[model samples]
Every structure is written in C-alpha cells, then in structure tokens.
Target chain A: MNISHAAKASGLPVKTVRYYADIGLVAPAGRTEAGYRSYDAASVRRLAFIRRAREFGFSIEESRELIGLYQNDARSSADVKKLAAKRLEQIEQKQRELQVLHDELKHLVRACRGDNRPDCPIIDYLG
Target chain B: MNISHAAKASGLPVKTVRYYADIGLVAPAGRTEAGYRSYDAASVRRLAFIRRAREFGFSIEESRELIGLYQNDARSSADVKKLAAKRLEQIEQKQRELQVLHDELKHLVRACRGDNRPDCPIIDYLG
Candidate 1:
C-alpha cells in the first residue's frame, strides 16, 4: 500500500505515516517501478502497532523500544511492563504540574474584581 | 539595552525574546546603528509579563492578549479574569486527560505478567 493507504489502515495521519517512513521507524517495504513508496503487509502492521502505542501516550523513542520488544520473539515481558510504568509516572508528573497551574490560576481568577474597573489582580500578579 | 540584556532582565531566553519580536507580539523598542535589536524599559517590562504568563501555562497567542490588555490603560478587569479562567479550564482539561492515560497505562502494567517470558498482555492488546 501507498503511504496514504497505510495511514488509513493504521488510523494515523498521512503526514505522520510519512514522518515514520522518513525517520526509519517504518520504512516503506519497497518502492514502486515509478519510485513511489509502497508498504508490505508487515510494514502496515507495524504502523498500526505504533499508532496504538502512540494513542497510549508513548513518545516516539519509547514507542521504538516497545516496537523492539514486539518484534523480538525472546523479549522479556518485564521490559514492556517497565516501559508502561515509566509512561504512567510521566503522566502523573504532568498531572501534578498542571494541578499546580490550575490552582494558581484559579486563585488569581478569583481575586480579580472582574468589572469595568481598570484594576485587575490577575494583571497585577502577572506584572 | 540590546536583546540579550532585555532577555536577561525579562527572565526569558534570548531566542524567545527574538521570536516575540519577530512575531510583533513585543517588538524591539529600537535598533542600534549597527542594526541590532534594542529594547526600552517599558518593552522589557512587557517581556517579563509575557514570560510570567507563559510560565503560568498561557500560550503565545494568549500571552499576546494579556499583553494587549496590560498596555491598554482603560482595559476592563473582567477581560483579564476571563483569560485567567480560560487558562485554568485548559489546565483542568489536561489534568483529566493525563489522569485517564495514567489509569489506563497503570491497568495495562498491572495486567502484564512481566516475567522472562515473551508473552505480554500489553503487546497482545496492542496487536
């Protein structure tokens, strides 16, 4: 299949599929006679796997590790679990950071008079 | 002062200051005879405010709006409070999304056997 077809099959954007091909994460299985990129069934399958991993919030580098484990017949399940745990921790860190921002902004929002007056606690704090 | 000095005073990276200047969000106060960017004290203050807003999770476009209100002496406090409320909502939405991802990944991690074996429920689910 062409990049667009592969992207459709994988439920990924065409640009993302092209980026994967360019980055060598999922190179086209072959080139057509006219030099068009073409992917085999296995390449399409790999793209689908990468799509699922990304939807699970894996970064490209982490997805590469998962892809390695996926392809390695003797790979340890422990490695996969570790990777997933790391992603969970990263999500937790982001949530904590966002929570802090949420609370801080909420406080500023509350403190503001929010009327026709030029004076604003939110602007005062930002300044 | 030159862009670097302005950036230092504003606690923003030199590149970021340059970007703001280029985008016309915070244009340089003037240019030196040597054609280097120069910023006045008032411009520096605006840059500092923008930096603080960004740290508070405001996007560049949102920062521009805040800066506009800051420069407008007749600006209503209600506008500033509305912006802050919007930022708070954005942060909350991100927290919810991250929490969902965290829970899903945690579930997958728990289900995995995580042993020397090649079998992985995570991989199976992805597949």
Candidate 2:
C-alpha cells in the first residue's frame, strides 16, 4: 500500500506518517519507481505499533527504545520490565503534578463567584 | 541581581534561565555597561512564576498566555478560567492515556514469570 493507505489503516494522519518517516520512527518497506513510499502488511503492523505506543504517551525516544526491544529476539524480559517501570514512574509523577494543578484550579474556580463582578480569586492567583 | 543570582533564586539552572530569555519566556530587567544581563526583584518574581507554571505542566506557549493574563489587569476572569479549563482537560486526557498504558504494562509484567528460564510473556508482548 501507499503511505496514505498505511496512514489511514494506522489511524495516523498522512503528515504524521511522513513525519515519523522523516524522524526515522517508521521506515517505508520499499519505494516505487516514482520514488513514493510503499508499505507492506508488516510495515503497516509496525506503523500501528508506533501509533499505539504514541497513544500510550511514550515519547519518541521511548518509542525508539521500545521498538529496539521489539526487534531484538534475544531481548531480556528484565530490560523490558525496567523500561516499563521507568515509564510507569514517569507517568505517576506527571499524574501527581496534574492532580495538584487540578485541585488548585478546582479550588480557584469554586472560589470565583463567576458573576458579572470583576472580583475573582482565579485572576488573583494568576496575577 | 545578575542572571546567575536570578537563576539561583528561581531554582532554575543558568542555562535554563538563558534559554528562557532566548525563547522570550523571560526578559532581563536591564543590561550592565559590561553587557551583563541584570535582574531585579520583579524579574525574579517573573522567573519564579514561569518555573511554577512549568511545574504545573503548562507548555511554554501556555506559560506565555498565562503571563499575558497575569500582566493584563483588565483581563476577564472568564479568559483565565477558560485557559485553565483547557489545560485541565488536556491533563485529564493524558492521565487517562497513561493509566491505560500503566494497566497494560502491569498486566504484561504480571503475566511474565521472572525466572532463570528464557521464556517470558513480556518479551512475547513486546515482540
């Protein structure tokens, strides 16, 4: 299939597909005589894997690491576990930070009268 | 105070302070005759605010917007509320995605029997 087809099948935008290719995230299976990228079923699977990993909030670097592990036949489960553990810790940290912000914002929103008056705790906090 | 002092006071690295200035996130208060960037208390406050906003997971662009709100005395509380709401939504979405990934990883790890044997469900999942 063409890049567009692969993109559609993978649920990623054509531009994103091109970008992944440009960033060496996903390489085309082959190129047509006209120099357009071509993707086979395996390429589509790889694109899907990349897309799913991205949706899971893996950074490009993390995705690259995961992909490397995916390709290595002799890869140790321990290594994969370590990477997953690190990613989980990072995610938990982000969640904690977001929870704090969310709590603060909720408090501010609640404190604000949200009326026609200019007085607002939200503005005060921001300022 | 010099940029180094401001950096120390703000709990940011000198390189980060310079990067923030370079990216127009923070501006120096004044310039010395010797071409050194100088900061007063106001600059320090601004840097602190920027760092705090970053800790709250606001992007550089979002920080810029919030800074504008901070400076605009006549700004509507509604505008700030909207931005905060948007940020909250984004954070929630990320949290959800991360939660899903965390669950999947936990499942994979649990399925993997960590033993001396080479067989592993984690590697199977990755591959």
Candidate 3:
C-alpha cells in the first residue's frame, strides 16, 4: 500500500508516518518506480506497534528499542520491563511536578478578583 | 547589563533570554557600543514576569498577551483572569489525559513478569 493507506491502517497521521520513515524509526517496505514510498503489511504492523508504544508515552528512541526487541526472538522480557519501569518513574515525577504547578496556579486564580477593574492578583502573581 | 547578567537576574537561561529577544517576546533595552544586547532593570523585570508566566503553563503567544496586559495600566483584570482560566482548563484536560495514559501503562507494567524469559505480556500487548 501507499503512505496514506499505511497511515490509515496504522492509525497514525500521514505526517507522522513520513516522520517515522524519515527518522528510520519505521521505514516502508520499498519505493515504487515513480519514487513514492511503498509499505507492506509488515510495515503497517510495525507502524501500529510504534503508534501504540508512543501512546503509552514511550520516547522515540525507546520505541525503537521496543521495536527491536519485538522483532528479535532471542530478546528477553527483562529489557522491556526495565524500559517500562523507567517510563513509569518519569511519569510519576512529572505528575508530582504538575501537581505542584497546578496548586500554585489554583491559589493565584483564587486570589484574583476577575472583576472589571484593572487590579488582578493573577497578574501581580506573575509580575 | 549584558545577556548573562539579565539571565541571572531573571532566573532564565542565557539561551532562553536570547530566544525571547530574537522572537520579540521580550526585547532588550538597547544595543551597546559593541552591538551586544543590553538589558535595563525594566527589561529584567519583564523577563522575570515572562518566566513566571511560563512556569504557570502559558504558551509563548499567551505569555506575550500577559506581558502586554502587565504593561498596560488601562487593561482590565477580567482579561487576565480569562487567560488564566483558559490555562487552567488546558491543564485539567492534560491531567485527565495523563491519568488515563498512566493507568493503562501501569496495567501493562503490572502484567509483565520482568523475568529472564522472552515471553512478555507488555511486548505482546504492543504487538
């Protein structure tokens, strides 16, 4: 299939499919004589796997590693578990940081009068 | 003051200060005799304000709007409140999305055995 068909089947955007190919994350099977990118069923499968990995918040490089492991029959589950653990740690840290930011912003918003007057504590807080 | 001094005073990185100046988000006071970017106290204050606004999760364009409102004495507090409310809404949306992602990833991680064996549910799930 062509890029559009591959993208549709993989549930990825056209630009993203192109980007993955450009970055060598997931290349098409081959190119047509007219120089358009060509994808086979296997490529579409890999693309869908990458899309799922990305939706799980794995980085591009991590997705590449997961793809490698997914293809290599000898690869161990421990490596995949380690990467998922690392991602879990990152997510937890981000959640904590976001909670702090959310609380501070909430406090500032609560203080602001939001009236027609020019006086705003939210502005003052930022300033 | 030079860019370094401005960055230190505003608690922003040197690259960020230059980027803000280049994008006209926050311009310097003037060019020195050697054509270096010179920042006055007022510019430093504005840079700090922008830094705080960004920490509160405002985009560059939104930060520009907040800066404009901060500078304009005739501006109403209601407009600033509106911007902050929009940001709060965005943060809430992101929080919900992250929660969903976190939960799904946690489930996948939990199902994985993390052992030496090649059989892994995480890989199977992605596949």
lDDT by residue (A1-127, candidate 3, tens digit) is: 9999999999999999999999999999999999999999999999999999998889999999999999988888899999988998888888888888888888878888888889999988888
Query: Per-residue alpha-carbon lDDT of model 1 for A4-115, expressed as tens digits?
Result: 8988988889999889988989888999999988988899999999999998889899999999999999999999899988888888888888888888888888888899
What is candidate 3's TM-score against the reference?
0.94
Model 1 earns a TM-score of 0.89
Highest DockQ: give the candidate number.
3
Query: Residue by residue across B12-86, what tens digits does model 1's lDDT show?
Result: 999999999889999998998999999999999999999999999899999999999998999999999888888
Return whichever of 1 and 3 wins on lDDT: 3
Listed models, DockQ each: 0.75, 0.35, 0.83
Per model, the share of native interface contacts recovered reads 0.90, 0.27, 0.81
TM-score of each: 0.89, 0.76, 0.94
Scored by lDDT, the top model is 3
> Which residue pairs in candidate 2 collide?
none
**What are the per-candidate TM-scores when only chain A is compared?**
0.92, 0.91, 0.92
Give the Å shift of residue B71 in candidate 3: 0.9
TM-score-best of 1 and 3:
3
Q: Residues A33-104, candidate 2: write the lDDT tens digits.
A: 999999998878778777777766678888888778777767776776776677778878877876887788
Question: lDDT by residue for model 2 over B11-104, one digit each (tens)?
Answer: 8899999998999988999899998999998888788888877876779999998778777767676777777778778878876876877788
